[model samples]
Target chain A: MRGDVQMRTMESSYSTKEVTKVPGWHGLVAWDLLFNNLTTGLFLFAAVGELALPGLLAPVAKAAYPVALVFLLTDLMLLVLDLGDPLRFHHMLRVFKPSSPMSLGTWSLTAYSLPLTLIVAIEAAQALNLLPAGSIVLEWVRKLAVVVGFLPAFGSLAYKGVLFSTSSQPGWKDARWLGGFVANSALMLGCAEMLAMSVLSGHSKAAASLRTVLMLLLLLNIIPAGLLFAEFHNTLSRLYRERQVYLALVLPFVGGTLIPLILLLVGDSAPGILGAVSLILLGSLAIRSLIIKIPHASREK
Target chain B: MVIRELELAGLPQASDPPIGPLSALLRRLTWPFRRGRAPQPHPATGFYTDTTVCIGCKACEVACKQWNQLAADGLNWSGNSYDNTAELSATSWRHVKFIEQFAANGRPTYPDHADSGAPSREVTLDQLLSGGGADRWLMMSDVCKHCVAAPCQHACPTGAIIYNEFANVYIQRDICNGCSYCIAACPFGVITRSDFDGHSHKCTLCYDRQRDGLVPACAKACPTASIQFGPVDELRDRARKRIEELHARGVPEAYLYGDEPGETYSELHSFYLLIDRPAIYGLPEAPFNPWLHLIGDYMRTIVSGLATVAAILAVLFLQGS
Candidate 1:
C-alpha cells in the first residue's frame, strides 16, 4: 500500500518560468515617509543652527523652530491616521524592542516631541514677554532644550531610512544607501523651509545666509540620492528603466539640486529665492514618493 | 385551606449535601487563585508539508477556511494555469499551486529559452494520458512559515505579532495598530492587510487546536497525508528520512526548506519538502533579516551626522575669525 502511494506521487516536473510578486506597501506609507522626513528634518536643521550659531542666526532659528513643531504635530496626526487601529496606537509605546525599527521609532518620536514642545512653549512665552527678559533661568532652559532635542531629532530623521532599508522588498533592501539619502534630503528640506520663512518675513540677511546654507545642503543631498539611484540602476534595472524613475531623478536634480544651486549662485533675491525654495520642497516630496513607488513599479510587466 | 395543609405535610424540606474530602481536595487544587503561576510553554509544533504527495485537491484549503471562519476569496479565474485563487492573501490562508509542464517525444518544451533556438513542442491530451511523453503536474499547498525569529514580530510597532506558547507566530488583532510594517518585513510575503478591517492577517499555525491536543484542520483534512502535523524536531527527522528515501529511489532534487536556521533569520517551525528550487514555489532563495544589516547602517549614519556637525562648526569658526 505504501509503495503504491509512493509510486503514484513520485512524478517529476520542470518549470523554467519564474514568478515575480508585488510589494504590499501603499500610498499611506509613502505619505508617512514624506511627513516623517520633513518634520524631523526641519527640527534638526533649526536646532543645529541655533546651537552652532546662537547669536548670528537666532531670529531665523527661533522662527524655524515653531514652524518645525507645527509640522511635527501634523506628522504625528498623519501617523495616527495611517494606523489600521488608531485607537490601539498606545500599544506602540507599551513595549520597546531594540531589534524592531518600528518600536524604536515610536519611542523616539514620543521622546523627541517632549523637548520640542518645551522649546516651542518657552520660546512662545519669551516672545510674548510672559517670561522675564534676560533671565538666566530662561537661558539655561533654552540651552537644555536644544541639548535634549538634538539626539531624538537626529534619530527620528534617520529612522525612516532604516525602516525602509529593513523591509524585505527587493527594491528597498538593495538600496541600503536610502538611510543616508533620506537624512540628507530631510536636512535640505529643512533648510529650504527656513529659506522660505526668511524670504516671506523679509529678513534679507537671514534669507541670504539661509540661501547659502540651503545650497550647501542641497549639494550634499545629491551624494546620497545619486548613490541610491546608481544602486537601484545596478540592482533593479527594470524599475530603473521605468519613466517614473527618470522623473524621480529629474525632479530632484533639476528642482532640488540644479535650480537651487543656480539661484544661490545668482545671488539671493526675494522672489527668485522663494521659487527655488518652493521647488526644493516639492522635489523632496516627489523623491520620497518615488522611492516608495520603485518596488511597486518593478512588479509591473 | 385544610386540603392544602394536608398536601404540604407530605413534602420533605431540601437541605445542602456535605462535600467529600476528595472533592474538597480537587476543588482546592483546581482553584483559580492557586493557578496563578505562569502557564507552561507547549512543545514546539509545526506542519511538514511534503509537496511531492499533494494532489491539488485543495481539501486543506477548504478545511482551513471552514475551521478559521474565513470569507471566500470569490470564484475568479486568474488565467494562471489551474490556480484560480492565485497567491495566499488575508482571506485565503491556504493556497494550492498547480504547475503543469509539458514535453513532446520525451523532450521538454523550453518556453523560457524561446530565443535560444529551442524547438516549441506541444503535447496533446491523448499523448499525455497514454504516458508516451514526459508531461507532469506538481501541486503544493503553501502557508505561513511560522519562523522562530519572525520578521513580522520584529516589525510590529505595537508588539501585536508574537510567539505563542506553542512556538508559533501569532498576530493579536486587537493590539495591531495596522501600521503595515510587518507586511513589508515579511520575506515570504505571507501576511496581508484586510481591506475591511485594515489589520495584517496570516496563518496562526493553529495554536488553539494545538492547545487542545488536536491536529490542525489542514493536516487532518489532507487525504494523502501530505500535510503532516507534529513536533517540529520530529517532523524535521521525518522529512530527512523521506528525502533520503526519495534520493535512494532516484529523486535527487528533494530538499527541506526553512528546516534549519540559515544566514537570514531562524528556523521555521512549519517547513517544507520541495523538489524544485524555492523560487519555483515563490520563496526567496536566500532570505534576509533586517535586524542583521541594521548595525552597520546605523553606525554609518552616526558617523556622517557627526561629520556634518564638525563641518558646520568649522565653517562657523572660520566666519567668526
Candidate 2:
C-alpha cells in the first residue's frame, strides 16, 4: 500500500519538514483496517484450536474448527494460488532449530496444543460424566485448561513479533522497537473481541476496560511509530525509500493513532468508545499489512 | 597437623578441575559473545567479490550447485533480460544478476547526440578499452553482504543462525525451520529458501572452507582472481589500490560497494568494487534495519497505552456522574 502510494498518489501527504501533517482518510479506510485485524485474530485463534483438539470433541470441534481453519489455511493457499507450489512446506520443519521463529512457533504450537487437546478430551469426558465430577483428574484438568489454554492464546497473540523481528528487512528488524507494535496490536485485537462481547453482554466495565486497553495500545503505537519513522528516515537517508516508510507507517498513525486518541479524550460515551475501538482495530490491521508487504534485502555481512 | 595433611594428601578437591568438558560445553553454549583466554582470535573469515575482473562467467553458480548439490534450473529464460535464472530462489543460493543498459554512462550518454547525426563510431567494449569513449558496460556479481548487524540473526527466535568467531553468518542446518525471515530480512536480496528443503540458504562465505584454511569455493574457482578471498583489512587495502589504479587510468566511476567505513556495517566483509551506483547493481544506497526505528514505535505504544488508560478512567467517571 505504501509502495502503491509511492507509485500512484501525486498529492504530497508527506512533507520534508520536522513536522509534516497528513489529511484524514474516510470511514471506509478505518473500517477496512478493523476488518483485517478481526479476520487475522479470529483466523489465528481457530488454528490454535485445531492443533489443540483434533478428535476428542469430534463433531463439535470438527464442524466448528474448519471455520477458523479454512480462513487460516486459505491465506497459505492464496500465496500458492499465485502460480507457486505449496508442497515445499514440509521442508520448513525437516531440520528445525530452536533459534528460528518458525521452528519455535512450530514447537510452541505442538507444546501448547497437545494440552489443549487434553483439555478438550477432559471436557468431553466431563460432558459425558465418564469421570466423577469431584474426581481429582477432572478438577486438575479444569485448572490446567485455565492456565494452559492461555499459552496458545497468548502465543498466537505475541508470535507476530517473532515473524517481524527476524526479517532483515528495514521495517521488521527493529527488534528493540517492535515489542510495542506487537503488544499493542495483540492487546487491541484481544480487547476488540472483549469489546464486542461487552456490547453483546451489556456495556460492562470488563468490556470498557478492554476498549480502554485497545485505545491505549492504538495511541501507544503512534508516538514511537512517529519517532521510528524519523529514525528510519535518518537511517535510510534516501528519499525514494524513506518516503514509502513515512506514508505507510506515519500516515496511518494519524487516523489510526491521533484521531482515535482525540476521540477517546474528548468523548467518554458509548459511541465514543465504539468509534475509538473501531479506529484502533483498523489502524492495527493496516500497520500489520504494511509490515508484511514491504520487501527488504539482506543486511548480514 | 600431620593427620590433616595426610587426609588432604591425594584426594582431588571438588574445585580442582573447573575447566572440564562440561564446563567448556556450558561456556560455549552460554557465552556466545565472550572471548576468554583463547588460542588466537578466531580467523576473520569473509568473501571478497572483485567484480572488476569478472567475465560474467556462471562458474560460481555451477560450483555452488555442485557443492550444495542443488537441483537443476532446467535452462528457462525470463525474456525480459539475458538472465536465465530470473532471481534468487529457495534452491539457488547463488545467482548472477545481468543488467543491460543502452546508455553506458547510465543516462542519455550524449543528450543532444542522437541518430539525427551522421554515422557514429561503433562504441564497443574493445573500443572503450582501447581509448577514451563515451559508452561503457557495467557488470556486477551480487551476493549476501554478510552484515555484522544481521536482522536475520537478531530475529531468529530459535537461534538457528549465528555469527561465527570469524564473524561469518552461519545457519545451523539442523536448526533452521525455514521461516524465510532471513530471506525477507536480507537487504541485498541474497538469502532464499530452498524449494527442495524449505530452510533459508545463502552464501556461507564458505565457512567450511575458512575453517579448513581455504578460500571460498566461488573465490577459488574464479580463474581471473575476480573474487579475492582473504582477511578483510588486506582485501580492503588491495581494493583501495585497485580503485586508485582504475582512477589513475581514468575510470572515474570506479568505486567500492558496501565499503563505507562508518556506515551501518563496519566495512562489509564481502564488499565489492563497482563502476556504477550501488542501486544500479541492485543495492539500496542507504539501507537500514527496521529495528532501529522501533524506539519510536515503543513511544507511540506508551502514549497509546496512557490514552487507553485515561479514556477508561474518563468513561468510568462519566458513568458515575
Candidate 3:
C-alpha cells in the first residue's frame, strides 16, 4: 500500500483497522491513475498559460511549443503503461464525463495538445521560413496556431489542483489553495520563459514588457503562498503537525515565493536582475520538487 | 459488569400465541439499538493482548496471510531488524513487530507502562553487538484498531471505502477511482493503494468471518490466545482485569494502546493492552482524526468559489466597459 515514497514528504500518523484480504493482483492501477493525472495535468496547464498571452510576451511564444510537445510525448508514454493496448487510449475519448477529473483531464490533453502541437510545428516552419509567408494557407495556419495554443497549457496546470483537492485524503481535501498554486506556478513558469526569450532577444522594448509581466507575476505568486503556509500551519491533522516544518511548506515558500518576490520588488538592478531570473527558475524547480515530495499515504511504511 | 438482557413482552410467545396490543407496545421499547434511540457508544470495544502469555508463534501472521490471500512481499531480508517483511504493506496486511530493549529496574514487560525501562546491565560495545544479555525483546502482532471513528473511511474520495454494518472499514474495489486521497488522508499510513488493482485496500476486521459468527483468522489461529477477538465490551473488562493482575505481579508498564476513549480515537475496537509506550512499537504517542481539516476545506472552497466568480465578473464588466 505504500504506493510510493513521493506521497510522504510530510510527517503524519493515524490509527485504523487493517483489512487483511482482497481478491486480485497488487494495486498498480491506483498508482497509474494518480501518477498519470498528476503528470499530464501539470503539463497541460503549463502549456495553456504559455500559449494564451504570446503577443504580450518577449521573443514571442514559439519555444513553449517544443517544451509542451516534449511533455505531451512524456505523458503519452506514461499513458501507454496504463493499459493492455496503448492504441486504445482513444477509447477514453469515445465518451466524456465533465464530473470526472480523469475524463476531463484526458479530453483536455487530447483536445488542446494536438492543435498546440500543430501550431508549434507551423510556428517552427514559419520561423525557418519553410512555409511561404505570402501563401494564404500558411498565414491562416499561423493565425489559428496563435489563437489555439493556450488552452492545454492553462488547463493542464489548473486541473491538477482540482484533482488533488477533490480526493478524499485529508491532506489533499484542505488544498483549496492548490488551484491558485498551479496558476501561480504557471505564471512563474511563464515568467521564466519570458526571461529566457528576453535574454536571447537583447534589451528591446519587448524585453522591458516581459520584465513587467515577470514582476507582476512575482507578486501574484507570493501572496497566495504565504497564505497557504499560514493555513497549513493551522491544520489539526497529525500529518500537518511538525516540530519544524520543512520542504512541503517552508522550503517552497521561501525558495519559490519570498526570494523571487523580494528580487522582483527591488526593480531588476544588477544583483536583482541576476537574482530574479535565478530565483524564479529555482522557484519552479522547488514547486515541482515539493509536488513530488509532498507525502501521499502510499509512501508511509 | 451487569448482563441485564431485558426480556420485554412481545406478541407470539410460544406459550401464548396471538399476543395482545400491550405486548406489542412493550416490545417496541425493548430494542435499544433501533432507530430514534440515542446510541450509547457500544460498550467501547478493545483488545486484550496478553503478551506475557504470547509464545511469538506467528500463527496469527500465517492465519492473516491465508485468510486475506495476500501476496508474499519483501521476502528478502531487510537487515533493518529481524522483520524481513519490514512493515505492513498493500500485500502484507499483518505485521509482527519485534522490539529489542533493556528490561532492568524490574519493570514488567507490559504495554501499559508509560515510562520506558531504566537502564539494564550496560554491556560493552562488543558485547552488545554479540547479543549479550539484551534485556527485553517485545513481540507484538500489529493490526488496524478498527478505530471508533475510522479516519480512512472518512477520507476516501470515490466513496470506494466505507465502514460496514460491523463498523469495520471496508474498501469497495469497484467504486474506487484510484485517486489515492485516502492514502494521504490516513494519518497512521495504514490504508494504502494496492499497486496492482489501483484501488485502496486494508484489513476488513474479517467481515466474512463475522458474518459466519466466527472470530478473525488471527484470533482463531492464535495458539497462545494472544490475539483474542470478540465483543469489544467484554474484551475491555478482560484487559482491565489482566492489567491489574500484571501490576500486582510488579509489571507496571502494562497499559492499553488505543484503549482510552477520550485521548485517542474515542475507542479502538481492536484496541490493545500493551506493556510499553506505543512509540516503542511504532504507534504514535497520540493519534487524532484528520477530519478537522474539513473546516479549512469548507472555508477555502467557499472563498475560492466567490473569488473565481468575482474575477470572472470583473473581466466581463471590463470587457463591457
Candidate 4:
C-alpha cells in the first residue's frame, strides 16, 4: 500500500504535455483587424480634415471618403464570416452587455457605419450633381455626419484593442497598454493615409500639412508603443526573449516610424512619400498578425 | 341511554387521511402555479475528482459517452502515451490523461519498498507491470471546471453560456451564434466548437440526471469512487477530510486545485484533489480573468486618444502661429 501511494504521488508529478491546438482568431480575423483600423483611421482623418482645414484639405478628405466606406463594408463582412454561424450575427445586437467587448464593438460598428454611409452618399451625389453643391442642407448634412461619426469612429478604432485585451491569452491579457498602442497606430496610419492620398492626387499644399501631422502623430505614438514594450518585457519576458519580439516590435519601430520620419525630412518626391506610407501599413499588419500568432505561453512548463 | 351510547361509538377520529399516488402526482404537476408559494432552490451539484485512487480504468469516460450519447472520437493511437483520445473536445467531454514517470537513469522513480532510502530504484517496465517494481503511472480524469465566476459567461456576447437551475454553466445550443469568444475566454481551454454543428460544447455536468435526482453517470460508473459527485458543500467537506487522511497516511503533497477563489477567477464548482502542482496536470497555476484587466486597458486607450487629439491640435496651432 505504501509503495502504491508513492507510485501515485510520483505519477502525479509527471507532465501531461497537453497543449491546446485550436487556431484562435487567425486568417480572416487578422485581416479584419487591418481593414478595421484602415477604415476607422481614414474616416477620422477625413472628418477632422474637413472640419479643421476645409479650404486646403477638403478635396483630399472627399477622395478618401469612398475608399474608407468600402473598407468598412469589407471589415463587416469579414467579421460575420469569422463567426461560426453567420446567420445568427444579429443576436449580438439583441442585448446590450457592457461586460462584453464584442457587444460593445458590434454597436460601435453600427453607429460608426451609419453616419459614414450618409457622408459618402452625400459626397457621391455632390460629385455627380445629384445634390446641389454648397447648399445649406448639404452643409448641414456634412456637419451632422461629423458629429455622429466622431465617437463611434474612435470607439471602433480602440475597441479592436479592447477585444484582444479581454482575451484570456497571456500574450494579450497582460498587455494592458495594447489598447493605447493600437489606437496610436491607427492615428499614425490615418495621417500617413491622408498624406499619401494628397500626394498621389497632386495636392502639394495638403500633402505638406499632412506630412507635418504625420510626424506629430508618430512622435506622440512612441509613448504608447514604448509602454507596450515595457509592459511585455516585465510581464511576458519569455515572449520578449523570443525572435517574434524583433519581428513584431523592432521591425515596426524601424520601418513604421524611423523610415517614414526620414522620408518626411527628405525632399517631397511622390515615390518617397508613397514608399513611406506603404512601410507604415506593412508594419501595422505585421504587428497585428504577430499578436494573433503568439500563444499565451503555457504555465511555466 | 342506549341511543347516546351508540352515538358516542359512531364518532370517528379527526385526523387527515394519507394522500393517494394519483393525487400526489396531480399536486406535483400543479405545484408551480400554486399561489404565493416561493420556488425552492435545488441543491448545488458538482464533481469531486480525487486523483489518488484513480486506476485509469476509463470506465468513467465510457459511461459519460454512453450517457450523453456522444459519438466516438475514433480509435487512432496518438503514439504519445497510453492516452488514445488525446484531450477533451466537443465530442469527448470527459478525457483521461495518462502520465508515465521514469528517472533519467532508466530506473523507476518509486521504490518497490518504502524502507529503501536510496533515490535510485532499479525496476524494469516488465517488473513494474507485474506490480513488483517502482514505476509510477498517474491518471487524471479531466472535465470542465464549471467555475463559479466563469469568464466565458462574461465574454459571451449573446448570453448563450449561462448558469442553469443546478448552478452549472450550460451553453444554450439554439442561442449560441458560435462567435467562439467563449472558447478564447475559457481559462481551462475546456470549451470547443463541434465540427458538425459549429456550436460550443462542454460538460453539462449531467444536468438532465441532476433534474431527475440521479448521480451523474461518470460518478455512478466509477469503480474506485475516484469521481465522486454530490452536493458541492458536502463534496468539499469530504474532499477536506480525505486530504487530511492522506496527509496522516504520509502523502503530504496533496492539494486542491480550483477549490477556492484566488487571484484567478472565482472558486470552481467542480474542483480536484491532486498530489502535484497544477501545471503538471495541464492546469494554469495563476489564471487571469480578462475582465479584471479591462479597466486599465480602457483607461490607456482613452489617454492615447487624448494624446492624438493633442498632437493634431499642436500641429494646427503651430501652423496658425
Q: Best candidate per lDDT, number?
A: 4
Give the TM-score of each candidate: 0.86, 0.59, 0.55, 0.85
True contacts kept of each: 0.37, 0.15, 0.03, 0.51
lDDT of 2 by residue, B213-321 (tens): 8777777777778778787778878889999999897767678876654445445778888765566556666666544543454354345434533443454344434
Q: What ranking of all candidate models by TM-score puts the best one first? A: 1, 4, 2, 3
Q: Pick the candidate with the highest DockQ.
A: 4
Candidate 4 residue lDDT tens string, B1-321: 112222343465467466899996675445423344323567777899999889989898999888877778887786536788777888788988777654435554454433454555655677556555445556789999888888889888877787887788888776777888888778787898877666788899998888888899999999999999988999999999999999997778888887788975798888999876677677777776778877788888989876886778678557745
How well does candidate 4 score on lDDT at residue A246? 61
Error of 2 at A205 (Å): 8.2
* Residue A34, model 2: Cα distance from true site in angstroms: 9.5
Candidate 1 lDDT tens digits, B121-230: 65456644544233456688999989998878888877778888888899976567678888888888788887767778888877778778889999999999999999
Give the TM-score of chain A, superposed on the true chain A, for all candidates in the order listed: 0.87, 0.58, 0.69, 0.89
**Model 4 chain B: lowest-lDDT 10 consecutive positions:** B1-10
Q: Which tens-of-lDDT digit does each residue in A173-196 have in candidate 1?
A: 777678878777777777788778
TM-score of 3: 0.55
Q: What shift in Å separates residue B244 of candidate 1 from its native position after superposition?
A: 1.0
Q: Identify the candidate with maximal TM-score.
A: 1
Query: How accurate locally, in lDDT, is each candidate?
Result: 0.75, 0.53, 0.54, 0.78
Report how far residue A248 has shifted in candidate 4, in Å: 4.7
Candidate 2: regions farther than 4 A off: A1-188, A198-301, B1-41, B79-81, B104-116, B119-129, B317-321
